[model samples]
Target: MVRTVLVLGGTAEARRLAEALAEAGDRLRVVTSLAGRVSRPHLPPGEVRIGGFDGVEGLTAWLREERVDAVVDATHPFAARVTASAAAATSALGLPFLVLRRPGWRQAEEDDWRWVGSVAEAAELLPTVGTRALLTVGRQELEPFTRLSDVWLLARSIEQPNVPIEAVLGRGPFAVESELELLDDHDIDVLVTKDSGGDDAKLVAARRRNIPVVIVRRPPSPAVMIVSTVDQAAIWVIYGHATVS
Candidate 1:
């Protein structure tokens, strides 16, 4: 029997999960949903849908309408609302749900890191730490830091940020060499970023420069079965159980 799976995607893991599931041949029907936030996103293999499902009500209706047998949320960790809605919608439908969350970066002994609960809190703490900051917290989350008059800010984004801060546009999986160049060229004294996990180029660059880093912690997510790797998540989607890998 073929099962229809809905994957809430936007991250590299999500794409990888979709690719893995697509390799299942006729056994499974995979549909990946993107947030449509990026103007040009790297299209993943298999069927793809763009934009929001509105909220829990809309998501529940979509799931029902699509006849989705299971759900895997591999969205950005900071996407709290989307995650919450997915959890709620799946619960209401009694569907098998899984969360693919990459583990967050660990603070090394040499790294000077200030952990904050939210982006606003990080912005508040930035003034006390350094005069200039390199912000890698994405374009949407930059509003909180825009009001700071004392600290000079340089931000990076896939698209231009709405705020007045100076920004360099680029997409991720950024190399440490490029990161080091960015830090050195800017004379950056501090780095502001979210705990998106996986790659740690910026973190490494900051450590090498002995610069302080203000890390915005991920928001609390709804309780769900979570797997830290694509292979584990793929196993869950296929066999309905997480096996030791």
Candidate 2:
């Protein structure tokens, strides 16, 4: 029987996992569910569904209706709500579930990293760090920084933010040289970002310029089986088990 796998996706790891599963032959039916937050999102291979599945009830119904055999959540680390909903829905159905989360960035001794629990905490600490700040915590996350009248905030996002702040529109896998130029051009003394983990180009730029960074730590998540790499996630989906070490 061809088992159907449902991937709750958004991040780069999710995209890569879809590609990996697509190449694994005809034993699996791969369906990726996107949150549709990005206007022009990079799509994955196989079948795709956009938007939320409402809450736990909606998702549970969808899973039952679609007959999803296994679920893999490859969403952003900050997307705790979706993760929780997926966990609950899958648990109630007694279906196989996995979380594919990439490891967070490590701080070198030379890197001046100020870790905060939330965006609000980062907002409170921003003024003390520097006068000019580069906010890379997504467009929706820019509200807290908006209230900081004393600090000059420049936010870079894939889409234009509704909030009042200087905007730089771009996407990632950014080169370090370009990031260096952006920091230099903006006269950014400090940087505020989330610990999204992969691609340390911006962090490298900050370190080169000797700028302190206010990084928002990821929130606590529900206990579930998790793997850090796409290979592990693919293994779990295919073989029903992943060697987590």
Candidate topping TM-score: 2
lDDT of 1 by residue, 67-95 (tens): 99999999999999999999999999999
TM-score of 2: 0.98
lDDT of 2 by residue, 1-245 (tens): 88899999999999999999999889999999999888889999999999999999999999999999999999999999999999999999999889999999999989999999999999999999899999999999899898898999899999999998999999989999999999999899999999989999999999999999999999886799888999989989888755555
Give, for candidate 2, the lowest lDDT window spanning 10 residues. Answer: 236-245
Would you estimate the TM-scores of all the predictions? Answer: 0.97, 0.98
- lDDT value, residue 209 of candidate 2: 92
Q: What is candidate 1's TM-score against the reference?
A: 0.97
Q: What is the C-alpha lDDT of each candidate?
A: 0.92, 0.94
Error of 2 at 212 (Å): 0.2
**Any runs in candidate 1 off by more than 4 Å, and if so which?**
241-245
Candidate 1 positional error at 192, Å: 0.3
